[model samples]
Target chain A: MRYEVDWSILARPELAALLIDGVRYTMIVAAVSTGVSLVLGTALAIARVSGSGWLRWPAELWVNLARHIPGVFWVLFFYFAFPELLPATWGSALNGWTSFALAAGIVALSVDNATYVSDIVRTGALAIPRGEWEAARCCGLSPWQQWTCCLIPVTLRTVTPPLANRTIHNFKNSSLCMVIAVPELTWATQQIESLTFRGIEATLVATLFYVTVALALGVWARRLERGGYRHWRGAGAVWRRERGELARVDSRR
Target chain B: MVELISVTKRFGERTVLADVSLAVQSGEVAIVCGPSGSGKSTLLRTLNRLETIDAGDIRIDGQSLYRSGLDLRELRAKVGLVFQQCHLFSHLSALANVTMPLVKVKRLGRGEARAQALALFRQFGLERRADAFPDELSGGERQRVAIVRSLALRPKVMLLDEPTSALDWCLRAEVVANVRALASRGIAQLIVTHDLDFACAAGDRFFLLQEGRLREVDNYTLACCAPEALRGLSSVPRGRLQAVAA
Candidate 1:
């Protein structure tokens, strides 16, 4: 009846393997989904702000649907309902696949994450005055060059924090894949809890895993938010490093 | 030469420009001066098609600018337009801002572009400020950076919208001098501002835009541009006329 916590269960080598595998899958899922979302989200942002209606409308529909619906619903939809919605041959092909759950999880997470990412990018991109675009154009940059070279770099300056936040959210959301029997960290924790009846230890490890990853991401995002990464040869740039080293050597001598 | 033939623009039901025709000859300094909301900026913007006309034909050197075959980026590069505010890329250093067009569009070597931009920055007296971001530079430095960036492409025509509005006396003189020097070197320029003194001083041909129409800026043109109520005072005595204007 007293409060006694046990950490001895995780001392086993098998338990260590299980936890490591869990961490591996969790990281893999987060990394894959984040890369896919960032690329897709940037395209969507460009479409939403584009002058053409063809590009704008479909992107608007996807963003509106993604933002309005809950992320969990998307996760569940991809896992449970998406293959059914596919044509029979494709659905059967998916059902026979070994990594169906992971693939579905990636699609679901990327789509859900992409919408918020697009929103962040669009807001940041739109915040730039129209004069900037005119200026770029006046300087003879093509539309493709304009967006890629100037607009996107500046947009990232404003969107980095929010983009990083959403990615971490997506990373945490990977735990939800456990609901579909994916062997992620949360799933491994549940298995240990049921098998060894020492859920406290497993739960603590899982909690620590998520906390450390999220903190690292937060710090990296802060670095990006400080900006000037795109600006060439800013104050204290690489060229000065040689001079600085020389000054140090002279003073030391 | 850059020519606007009956360039008309409207936003919703409000007509911003109506049958506005103007020309900027090579090496000419054409100034457009009018009160705010009189379409002075819009008129200058039309030279580079920054503001598209609902009905009009714009041509540069006898080539149709608004037509489908004309390349927009080329046309834009041909006629440079600098905004009233600095409009420098906040994320770019002054050197990078100047070099971007050279590297990206012109496909110049990075070293060459950097050299060109550094030279322009040096010429503009921004020697120590090349690596500075837009926020680090003062309003005048930013404006100079923007001008240098536009000039990197060697545009045949340059457009400046209220370049001196956000500047102090020293900065204004620098900007006006640079703009004048560009015109002297055979780049056609269209400058739009509300400052009559600047327009009179720099304009080879000054214009007064009123209620969507454009006209030459002369004494008769000024009297014609005045509202009907004010025109009645022109018949008054000289002192009374001055009082009325005041």
Candidate 2:
């Protein structure tokens, strides 16, 4: 079968509105889910390495289960299974609400994304030299202070590239909301496609938007990496210059 | 003052320290010399309770470190530890690393802590490198920064585990000089090293550790002067030293 071009449908004003709304919804879902996942994942990462069996076991189990389960299953579970388990009146209210889809999407994405975030953060924490921990202890920092003041900053810097990749993955995964009839980019594109029988046009534009945003984010991350490298290099050069001057002065003496 | 009473430590079936008892009086500088795997590092770590003793007790300034009714954080604040590999905080500037404990643990105001940190950095000849990160400094500079980071808390006692063992020959003197300066200020120090030269130059008192037991050598000058005795006390076996020098 041959595909037919539909340029008229692509030029419609209503189609643009749908695309704009879809983009806004996708951004919102990704932002909230990312925030939740970052906090939850950091706590889980700390627990896994805390050397306490009580904490490590639960954190490990949570990460493993979330990672093994499918994202779509989580969305369905929250949307369909969770309300049924609630008390009768609350369940009814939840099912009747217009915003239930958005909430379900947030929960689904947060759970799915947090496992990867925790894994990234755990690797960063492990990579820190053991000497750093001893130094913190010698300085009399409490366990909380050690984690908050010393560990997190170093871990975040080490893991930023991977963490940013996860954020992009989370953003793309927002497309999964289409299955639940959430008005995200994919769902809006499908709505436009069915109404006008111009699926190709809507699909192309949506794909373009996603690719552009992801590339823009990647470029920003590269800029950050370059800036960090330059700062460290300049500092290293200055140190070497000072050391050389001191060496020269000693030689003269 | 820190005292260890018949402390023993075991990992699995391997015994590291066996019924070893020692006392370090206030303002005393005691250097511990032993071979690799002789439990020298473990012994020093046990003083700070970093490694728990299997038996016996460690007391810091009349308070039992291994017993209840003592605040471990307070005890740790009073005792500083420096490792062979300097563990300056990678994320913070040298000044921030030095000042972190003052602000976070001691609750000093930011301005006051900065002033104190700047003074310590200057004292250690790190004033120019105060704003540098750990990765930005040389190996010698990083070790000096590590010493200043420990001294920021003004701990009464300092425990050093092979502080210069990881340094090159050129960098070793700078670290040893810093340790000597700390000792001159009347700060009690327990330095664990296998280097005969460092032990001779930096130690006021020397203890030879072998097979998990310690024998104090009271006359350090005589010990250093007599090459045979010094070689026997050193972790390096006689044949290996001859081979390396030859």
Off by over 4 Å in 2: A1-11, A225-253, B166-177, B219-246
Clashing pairs in 1: none
Q: How well is each residue in B151-195 modelled by candidate 1, as lDDT tens digits?
A: 888999988888877788777777778978998889999888755
List TM-score per model, in order: 0.87, 0.88
Write the residue-wise lDDT of candidate 2 on A1-253 in tens digits. Answer: 8988776776788987888899999888888998999998999999999989999999999998889988888888889999999999999999999999999999999989999899999999999888788777777888899999888877877887998899889989999888888888999999998888778888988999899989888877766555553244433453354445435534765
Error of 1 at B113 (Å): 1.0
Q: Could you give candidate 2's per-residue lDDT for residues B68-162 as a string of tens digits?
A: 67777888888888887878877677777777789888899866887787778767778777767788898778878878877888888999877
TM-score of candidate 2 versus the correct structure, residues matched by position: 0.88
Evaluate model 2: give its lDDT: 0.81
Displacement of residue A200 (Cα, Å) in model 1 is 0.8
Off by over 4 Å in 1: A79-97, A227-253, B218-246
